[model samples]
Target: MALRGTNQEFGRPYNRRIVLESIRLHGPIARGDIARRVGLTVQTVSTIVRELEEHGYVLSVREEPRGRGLPPATLRINPEGGYAVGIHITPLGIDAALTNLSGDVIESAHREAPNATPDLAFDLIGAMVNDLTGLRPGGRVLGIGMALPGPFGVESMSFVGPTTMTGWKDVSLRERLAASTGLPAFFETDMAAAAMGERLYGLGTGYSEYYYLYFGVGLGGVMVHDGSALRGAWGNAGEIGHIPVVPGGEACPCGNRGCLERYLSLEARGRWSGSDADWVAEIGPVFRNAIAVVENLFDPETVILGGLASTDLLERLAGSATQLPNSVSARRDRASPRIIVGRGGQYAVLRGAAALAVSGVLSPRFGQMFTAERERGRDLLQGKGMAA
Candidate 1:
């Protein structure tokens, strides 16, 4: 949904996020334009902009008058206004990045912890957090965000399979990471986090609605609507990896035969023992089926494929995905490609992990006011979320 602001004084925080988002998306724009875009009065926009300027979050770009009375000053987000740390935990390693307000990575660190236990991962994460923080002289470190393999909180599907890390079934990542780093922590499934990162800082920008197909250790996807994730009831809505694609095909860890990931994931690619072209050809039908499923079910503006793989590999998949079966996205008036390779290279999830922290402080949510006071101390936003 398009962001709108309330005039109610109690909605100040919400309005503040709206104003900031306006500037982030459409700035260096005039105060008048922000007011019109967010449905706030010019007076309220002025007030919010002034407060943001005072807080060093918004920067005035042009103040010189053109002709008439004081020309409206265009505003933009201050790149140095804040910073956040992002951590991506995979079976192979943990990738960490420290990002500025504009999603630029200031510093990064990677440590391998193959099949890492929770304790070992936490220790490495703590060291990385310290290393990243030490590199920065001065800035507001908003918090930390983590992206992990998904199917979270389920007895059968969470943190137990070959694709996921073991000894983490009972670990409360948010609380433990927060206590360890002394900064509030947030987390999401790798797929959703990649989608969020793509939406905010990569090719998914300007496309309000899209489906992100994440090719990680396993296959996964996320649905974004109006610039927010449509996280389902249990927060594992996009576990497309486990969906049955082939009847009586390969047996998957999640107790399914012919799961999509069995034929379409990195694990599957690893098992191929063939060239990239051969792998692409092998999975072409399954990839097209997955795209058709995404298109028919979600009808997203576009489907973005990305993750811990090479750009060349993702490009190959994108090329194969174009000759798809009849789906809702097959339109003669299409303005964009049906499927495209994502940006940010392999750091998409890492950037998304950082975005979780940035979004918590700056992005507006629907029920934030009611929960803000209660959740202030916790700062535990999780999963594929709508807030960013």
Candidate 2:
């Protein structure tokens, strides 16, 4: 669902974020249009816009008037107002990206850290941040967003599996990153980060409710509802790779037999020597079954396929897995395709890691509904001598 703003005194920050969200999504937009879209008064929107301009978060643009008294000025995000760095960690390597307020990737770096420990990952991250920050001297860096392999807080799946990184479960990654980079640090699973990237700057932008099926080192998914990620109680909602698609399939380090990732992931494909087409043909049936399960379970507006895979491979997989099984998504009145590839490119997770900071700044949090007004993720931002 679209976010709406309230006129209450306590909701001022939320209103500001709501206005920023509107502008980021549709700008250069008139203040009147933003007011109508976000359920706020024109006066309230104007106040917020003025404050945003003073803070250098929004810029005013003018268009030629056809025959009006004066050309109206519109608002847009100021690309140089802020910057964010995103880091994606996996057993295979570490990826980092620096993005501006407009979500454009300005610089990126990749380093191999096979079976990386916390210390090793931190070292790589420090080098990346230093190099990235140098590109824009004295740039106002909003924060750092880190995407780690997940199933966090779970013993069996957190750090003891083939898909996840190990020797770092007890380390406070967020706090450490904040200290090392001298910036506020935000954290999320790689899957969640990828999904969040899609939500803010990719295919999920057009749909509030959609399933992001990530094709990374392993298969993962995230169900986004009302523009909020449906993170489970323990923050591992979309570990679909562990689901048993084959009754007696290959064994997974998670202690599951016939797990979906065993037959439908990059790691699975790497074990085979066949050509790309041959690999797709081999896993076509398994892929279709997984898609069917995702559709019936989430019933999202559409399912997005993306992540560390190449565009050609992702499209080939999407094309080859045809004749989809009948499910709730097969209704005749559907407005969107049942399946579509994400447009965030191969480094989507890295972009999402950056977006974590951007969203934290521009998007209102669902958690604010029950709690008193406060800075989002301030606990991580504070005590590190960083501004929130």
Candidate 3:
């Protein structure tokens, strides 16, 4: 009946995960720092560190001198601990990559997803994982993170929204992948993954609160607050595509009139412009209008324009947004939030999935299991018997 299940059974694993996550996020971090950051006592942090070091999931580096006191030893994640596979399932193809703890892509493979069905997609993904895992540096893969078109529910394995692909709705994607590949799997909306990618490795870094405006086949926004993606009640937060931008412009599939996606999305532009360049020119104003709406409502630190929208297009849109009327007249002196292009481009979603997978492995909730596994492996190598 418990949401997270029994604490007695999950406590150690949870703590270990937290410790590993702390190290991954702020590595070359001292034990004291990990303790402070993870909200655990020094003794608990020391215990976790010992476990990680024994397992080879983490390694202690040479002490760095700070003052007259003894130099503090730093800890870092071991890239060899495990590997994660990230797959971006776009309308065109399945772009996949294998990455380690450091987010370095070791290998990549792509296959067209043209008219892809759930069975065919899962089979291809399984084969891709097999091929990539065969070439892994240590021949061991931890898990897989899949990036799919929006409205994904891992519990139900249902995908809602406008997807050209079939057999996707209500498909237990994670279960199928796990069964086919024999590894744990995680699923995330492509836009949400892209947002995570930006936070970890792209422009969204440093800012704790921001919005990633994904403008691809459709338009959506990913909201981040205090370094975590804000999934509102029912996990439907940041559904900006449905936000009303035009009262009678165009009808949307979501049973709405003149939705933001109808104006700002590439699919909408395709009806207006025959090519990508033409779409960029025509959609800039619409994109600017959407930005103005977001700025006026959320007033985020920055609005990251991404999806398939080009950098030049985003810049022009940013310039145009400055001309829109502001309702908050009292805050006229406040500088408007900057609108910038996402750095990952077409691969942003996949990159974000990989990053998310890596984070899961290094997260404090799962760190202990990894640490225990690593320590067991290390003990075997050292000819020291591990605890049963």
Candidate 4:
């Protein structure tokens, strides 16, 4: 399979990642099955599997058959192989959690940040990691994944554009976290991470194309196509928040008039309601407009309402959307895409981050061993090394 990044001199890491992803996606599969699935030979698969088993990332189960020459062995992911730490930083506070391979939260710590700031935020994250790692030493935390309120660059681990987050522009969050915790770090914008979480374990299950609208202090968007995020040029593909909806309504932080976020975000609703059923009545129109935009543009398989928004609010908005007249010309018997509420809600982003981090560690591509093995394999094929 084609690798996504620059070719590494050591290729074992890539192979490891491939093998791990195969097992994670299709476990209880035999070594021969894994080889066929990953496009690797049986010998290569066995080598990688043995190394994975030795490293505690894979476990084997013996299968007894009614009539068989020998019992076949099935391979599965070791849920306890390693742990991933995920954090979601919102305006109100920071939510930190640790999850295993199965995406089960083993420990969680919430820190209230009455006065949110970059310095305080980083400190809170460090403290949370320390707390969770201490609580589950046996889990061997591999790294940290942060879901922040901003736009993350697709090619890099930095914020892409202006964000509602204070003092977050051009911040090297990954480096800061690695320095603070002495562990590898990965980062994603809150919306994209939430979308990932939903795709893997929430309302997005079985849907290849969908949109996850993150309604928080600010509105954000995440688009998934073919089971992967569709990050546009400069990683700004999903900045639907800045999409002009009202034309000349309200001034937005992105220097636009009447951006979609100004009309539909939680903060906007709070202002509209003046604390009168603030969560529900205020966001109703915004949700309607958002649904209309999604339908006109992507017509996705489903549009998931998530982020910090409440499910009750989502249900109300979904009901309201259905009442709107279809704008499509000569509409036929095609079913309208369902507007569903997400399971993780506010915690979705953090959980998605945890999932990415865990996937990175448990699989071989994220580890050093996999890269080395691939490099050696290439060298041997090139006749640079003598065959045994």
User: On residues 264-317, what C-alpha lDDT tens digit does candidate 1 reach at each position?
Assistant: 988789889899999999999999988999999999888888988889999998
Model 1: residue 21 alpha-carbon error in angstroms: 3.9
Worst ten in a row by lDDT for model 3: 379-388
Tens-digit lDDT track for model 4 on 1-388? 3333223444555666677678887888998888877778788788878777877778999877768576779899888877789988877688988887767788888998843677888887888898888877665677788887765543221332233565566668888877877776787778888888888778777678878888776787887888787767766567787788787788776666888777677777666736535555655676676676776777677778888877776666666666554644115654545577778766678789998776655454454533444456532111212221
- Stretch of 10 with least lDDT, candidate 2: 379-388
User: How far off is residue 239 in model 1, in Å?
Assistant: 1.0
What is the lDDT of every predicted structure here? 0.84, 0.84, 0.71, 0.71
The residue ranges of model 3 lying beyond 4 angstroms of the native Cα positions read 1-11, 39-44, 63-70, 153-166, 274-278, 319-322, 327-337, 365-388
Model 3 over residues 1-388: C-alpha lDDT tens digits?
A: 1112113543555666677777887788998887767667788789767877887778888766668887878999888777788888866668888877776778889997775778888899999988988886454476788987765543322343443233577778778877878876777878888888778777777688788888766777888888778877766577788777777878776666887877776667656736556665666666666766777777777788877666776666666666555543226454545666767676677778877766655554444445666566432112133232
Q: Model 4: runs farther than 4 Å from truth?
A: 1-9, 63-71, 152-163, 274-283, 327-337, 361-388
Candidate 4 global Cα RMSD: 5.5
**TM-score of candidate 2 against the unseen true structure:** 0.87
How many collisions per candidate?
0, 1, 11, 15
**lDDT for residue 127 in candidate 2, whole number 0-100:** 89
Model 2 bad stretches (over 4 Å): 1-18, 33-48, 334-336, 362-388
Best by lDDT: 1
Alpha-carbon deviation at 104 in model 3, angstroms: 2.2
Model 1, runs deviating above 4 Å: 1-15, 35-48, 63-70, 364-388
TM-scores of all predicted structures: 0.88, 0.87, 0.83, 0.84
